[model samples]
Target: VLDRQGLDAFMRQIRSKFESSLIQDEKNERFPGYARRRWGGALKTLLAAIDKV
Candidate 1:
């Protein structure tokens, strides 16, 4: 039980870090624009599929 609790805590920390990175990325205008320009079609297709659901 202790091991499981420790693992859960570790996973939560990792998830928090990942969320922070995503927030940082969203705040970055240049990175987002570049990504959109590079993968505009794919992104749009993905968004459409998501919307359908």
Candidate 2:
């Protein structure tokens, strides 16, 4: 778990579109295939920053 590979695996283990659209896109602009760049990047960056902290 010291490297990014472990983190990626962790994400894959828990990630799920079925979790909820609100979680998948916090801003609630889209869901599933409708999600766009800003929403996708926002979620990724949020997770990355949290992992760093």
Candidate 3:
């Protein structure tokens, strides 16, 4: 039993957090010798590409 306003607010909050994290992660990705193992060097992909130097 959720109200319309309450549901909208909840969704907005979730979106805000998700967008913020995505932005930060992208920023971190644009660097030399950036090592990303688990989550992949960059997102929006099917598999992760490991960087080995």
The Cα local distance difference test for each model comes to: 0.52, 0.53, 0.44
Instruction: Give me the runs in candidate 1 sitting further than 4 Å from their true place.
Output: 26-53
Off by over 4 Å in 2: 1-35
State the weakest 10-residue window (summed lDDT) of model 2. Answer: 13-22
The per-residue C-alpha lDDT of model 1 at residue 26 equals 78
Locate the minimum summed-lDDT window of 10 residues in model 3: 44-53
TM-score result, candidate 2: 0.33
lDDT (0-100) at residue 43 of candidate 3?
Answer: 36
**TM-scores of the models, in the given order?**
0.41, 0.33, 0.40
Please rank every candidate by TM-score, starting with the best: 1, 3, 2
Clashing pairs in 3: none
* Candidate 3: tens digits of C-alpha lDDT, residues 1-53: 34556555655654555456655667686662333332332332222111110
lDDT of 2 by residue, 1-53 (tens): 34677656555543443244446566665454355454455557647855894
Which of the two, 2 or 3, has more TM-score? Answer: 3
> How high is the lDDT of residue 25 in model 1?
64
What is the TM-score of candidate 1?
Answer: 0.41
Model 1, total clashes: 0
